[model samples]
Target: MGSNFFHHPNGWVGTTPWWKDAVFYQVYPASFKDSNGDGWGDIPGLISKIDYLHQLGVDVVWLSPMFESPQKDMGYDISDYQAVYARYGTLEDVDQLIEACHSRGMKLILDLVVNHTSDEHPWFKESRSSKTNPKRDWYIWKPPRYDSDGNRMPPTNWRGYFAGSTWTWDEQTQEYYLNLYGPFQPDLNWENAECRAAIYEVAMRFWLDRGIDGFRIDTVNKYSKRTDFPDAPVTCPGVPDQPAPEMWCNGPRIHEFIHEMQAQVLAPYKAVSVGELSNTPLPKQVLPYVSAAARELDMVFEFSMIRLGTGNLFHGKYMYTPFPLSVLKRHVATWQTFIEGTDGWHTVFCENHDNGRAVSRFGDDSTPELWEASAKTIALWQATLTGTLFLYQGQEIGMRNMPASWGVEEYKDVESLGFYNEAVESGDEKRVQAILHGLRILARDHSRVPFQWDDSPNAGFTGEGVTPWMRVHDQYRELNAANQLGDPESVLGFYRKALGLRKEHRDIFVHGAFKLLAPQDESLFMYVKESGEQVGLGADGNRKKALVVMNFTSRVQRCPAISGALGCRKGDERLLVSTLRSGLARGRVEELRPWEGRVYLNFQP
Candidate 1:
C-alpha cells in the first residue's frame, strides 16, 4: 500500500496522508458535560472524559465552537476569536484539555468559524459605527437602493439562511450590511487584504500556536462572493427573495483564498483540515479542494447523503415521506467509486451537530429490540468503508430523535425557531402542524440535547437540582451509557468491537478495492473489499478479502451466496463479527434476521 500513488492532473504523484487512518469524534461542548453544575458543559468537564474517548479508539477529537459570543447562534457567531466563553472555560482550561488529549495519544481540533462574526464583535462594531471608520471595509456594506415610488429596497433579492432579507439595514451607518446567516451574524469581506490577514491571525494562528492539531472549518467554501451581488432568480413562489447559494458558494476566488490559507498556517503546523463545503456536492467541484495536488484541504464533509429525505422552501427540512433505501445505496456508491484510487479523500458520517440521530433517521428505532440491532448494523457499515469516520457524541449509545409530543418551545435552534414562527404568522394551521412534525424528526436540537451518562436527574449532565440548558431525552432512563458499559451486546459495545476490527485489518478495510453487490436491492447492502490487486498489497506476499453484508430493513431478508465471488470454498470462510448474539450460520449465510450485519474473512484464492 505504501508504494501506491495517485497521479494528479498537474503531473504530480501523491501518497496517503495521516488523517486517512484516523477516526474523529465531534463534541458539542455546551451539551457534553457540566463540571460546575451551571446547566452547561465546559472545558473542564471535557477534560475529565479523555479516558472515555481513548477507550473508544478515537484518534482525533473535533470540538465545536466554544468561543466568546452572545449565544445567538450557539457559538457560531464569534465575538472574540481568541477568548473562550465564560460559560465554557478560560483559555487556560483549553490548554489543559490539549495537554490531556496529547498525554493519552489523541489529537484535538477546534471549530474555525471565519465566514461571519457576531454583530457585537469589536471589528464589526467599528465597521458599523460610521462609513469612514478605519474598519468599515471589514464587512460587506452596500448603499440602499430605492424603487420608482421612493421606497427603500435591499441591494439584491437574496434571502438569509435563517429567514428574511440577506442585507440588514444599519440605523447608525445608514447603510445595509450583508448577513448570509441570521441578522446578528454579519458576513466578513474576504476581498479585503487587511481583513483576511486579521482573520488568519486570530482564527487559525492563535489556535495552532497553542499546540492544537487542526481545524474543522465552518462553511469553508463561502469565503468568496460575487462582487456584483446580482439578484438571484426566483425559485419559490410567494417569496420575494430566494436562496442564492450559486451566487456565493464556490465562487471564483475560493480556491485562491484557500491556497493562501494553506501556505500561511496549515502547512507550517502540519495540521489536518476537514472543511464543510456548503451547497457543493458534485465530484468535479469538490475534488479541487481535497485533492492532494491542490494543497487546500485534507477532506470535506459533503451533504448529498444527509439531504436525502429533506424538504425545501416552506417545509424547510421537515419531511412528509420516508427516505427510500435504494436511493441511499446509489448515493453511497457514487461517492465511494468516484474517489476509489484518486488524490481526493472523503468523510463518512451519519450524524453531526446539525442533523438528527443516525439510528432514528437511517435505521429502525421504533422498538427497543430493533433499535439495538439496527444501530449495530450501522456501526458495522461505517467501519468497513474507506475513509475517515466521524462519530457524533451520543451516536455510539443508539440515541434517537426527540419525541413528537414535545412543544415547539423545547427547540432552541435558530433555524428551527425561524421556520416555526414564519409558518405561524402566515395564519396557516395545517402548515404550522406539518412544520412542527418535521422539527420533531429533523431539528438540530435533537443532537444538541444533553449527553446521557447515567439514570440520575438531568441524565448525569448537571446537578440534581439544576435544570439543563436543553431538555434531556425522555428515554435516558433506559438508554444511558452506564447500563451499556457492562452489557457486551449494547450499541456502544458493538461500536468498539467494530472499530477494533477495522484497525486490525487496516490493509483490507482502509486500502482495499471496493465493489458494491446488488445495487438495486432495497433491503440488502452488500459489498466486497479486496487488498491485493488494487492497493499494491501483493508485494507483501499476502492477499486478503472481506465481505460485508447488512440488512437495512425491519423484516427478514434472504442473503446471497458469497463462495463464488470471494473465490473460496463454502467451509473456508471465517466469521469475524456479527451483530446478532446467536442464530447466525457458520460458513454461508442463507438468510439474515431483521437489521442484522455480518463480516467474514475469506481464504486467499
Candidate 2:
C-alpha cells in the first residue's frame, strides 16, 4: 500500500503512485488563446479553453511561466515569483484558471523558474548593488580573473545554453556574476541558506497557498554550478568553443538542494515537482533528482530523445540532420531499462515550447497528406508510452514548423536572432540559408505561434486587426481545431480516440513496463508495453499487455522482431490503433507505410 513500491518485472510488487499516471497538457499562456481582442493570449483566454482540454483527455495542465517577468526570455526571466505578469492579468485571473481546471476535474501546475531570476528582479537588483550587501550572496558572484599583466578575464572558461560567456560582468559591483543563460538572467546561489529558504517560502507560502497543484521546475539541474569555477572541457568533439555540459550542470549540491526544498515545502503540501533536467546524459545522473527515496522531485525530464536531431548540446540547432533511428533507440531503451526498478519516473514528451513541432521533427510534415498521418502517429506514440504524457499545445492538430520564407521579423526567440547574425557574419550565403532552414525546424519561436482555435481569420486566437506577439502558422486555415473536432480521420479526432485507451487500459499505458524492440534496426521503431503479473489497477482482473510498432521512414518495412518482442506470431495479436490503413497479417508487416504507427491490444505471449 506504500507509494514507494511497485510491480517489478520479476513478478513482485513495486511502488507506483498517482503522479505516475498523470497526463499533462503543457500550454504556453502567451500562445494558447486570446479572450479579449488584445494581440497577446491571456489567463482569461486559457480559462475559456477548459472544455477543449477536458475533451482532449487531459489530467493536468502544465501552464508555462506567467509569473511577473520582464519578457526577456518570455517569462523564464522572472522578476517576481509571487505575482502574475501584468500582460497575463492579475492573480485573480490565475485563480480563475485554476478554479476552471478543478471544475473540469483537472489539475494545474505552474512553471517554477527558480534556477535564475531576471536582472530586473528586486533580489537581483539588490544583490548587484554592492559586493558586501547581505543579499549579494544570493546570486553567484566572484572577482574577475587577473593575469600577471593585470588583464581582466572571466572567472572561468564557461559558456551556457545560448551564445556567450557564462560570466556577466557587473559595473556597479566591479565583480563578474555567473549566468548559465541570458546576460539579464543571473543564476541563483543555492549555496546561500537564506536564498534557499526564501525560495522555499515562495514555493510554499506564496504560490502553493493559492491552491495550485505543483510546479514544473525549469533548468533544474543547473541549480548547482561547479564550485571551483575552473575552465570547462569542451562538451562535443570539434566544438572547442563551447564549454562542456559538466561545467555548469549536474553539480555537487543538486540533490541536497532539491531534497531540502522537498522537506521544507513539497512534502508539507503533498504537491509534486517535475524538473526539467537539461544536459544530463545518463540515467544514474538523472536518478537522484527524482528517486522517491531521495524525496527530491516527483520526476525529471531528461533531454535525451529531443537531442537526437543535433546529436549533442554543443552542436546547437544549426546542424540539421535526420535523427538516426538507431541512436534514438539506444538513448530511449537505456533510460527506460535503467529506471525500471527504481522509484524515479520518466517525463515522456515529443515536443514543447522550447522545441520544434513534433509532426515536423519526428514525422513527415513536408506535405498536407503526410502531415495528418504523421501527426497522429506521433500522438499515438506519445499517449502509449510508460510515463507521464506531456502534450504541448497544438500537438493535437499536428502543427508543423514555421515557414522558411519568414525572416527575422517573424522570429521572436533570442536564440534565432543570435544565430541569424552569426550566420550572416560568416559571409556565406549557403550558411545563411542553412541557418534559417534550421531555425524553421528547431527554433523555439516555431512552437510559440498562436494556437489555432478555428479556421477564421487570425485562427480564432485573437480578433481581427490585432497583431500577436508572434506570427501564427500559415497552415492554420486548413488544420485548425474546428475542422478536426468531429472528423474521425482528423488528427485531433485520432488523439481523442487514442487517449481514451489510457482510461480504458490504465495499467498498460500508465504504470506498465517498457521494452524496446529491434534496437538494431535503423528504419522501423518498435517497442512493447506490458503490465506485471498481478491484476492491474482497474476493475478487470487482467494485466496490461500491448505491442506498438512504428515506421520512422517513408519506405515500407517489416516488423523485424515480431516474435521476440511479443512472444507471439503476427496473427495472434489484434490491431487496436493504426496511423495507416488496414490489418496486419503474417510475420512480415502488412503494408506498413511511411510514417505509420500501430498498436496491438489483446496480445499475449
TM-score for every candidate vs. truth?
Answer: 0.94, 0.92
lDDT of 2 by residue, 1-605 (tens): 11445444434455566577667999999998987777888999998889999988898999899988889889999998888888888999988988999888788998888889999999999999888789999999999888799999888876666766788899888999988878989988999999999888874558788888888888888888778777876555543346656866888888888888888888888887889888778788888887778888988888878766652354356657766778888877776676688877787888888899888788888877678768888888888877778889999988888887777788888777777776687687897887777777888898999998898888999988888778887878997999989787689988888888865665677767888877888888788888755654344444446888988877776654444456654565677777753343323466577778888865432
For model 1, the run of ten residues with the poorest summed lDDT: 1-10
Backbone clashes under 3 angstroms, per model: 0, 6
Which candidate wins on TM-score? Answer: 1
Clashing pairs in 2: 5-14, 5-15, 6-13, 6-14, 6-15, 7-14
The regions of model 2 sitting more than 4 angstroms off are 1-16, 147-149, 234-241, 426-431, 535-544, 559-565, 569-571, 581-589, 603-605
**Predictions in order: lDDT:** 0.86, 0.80
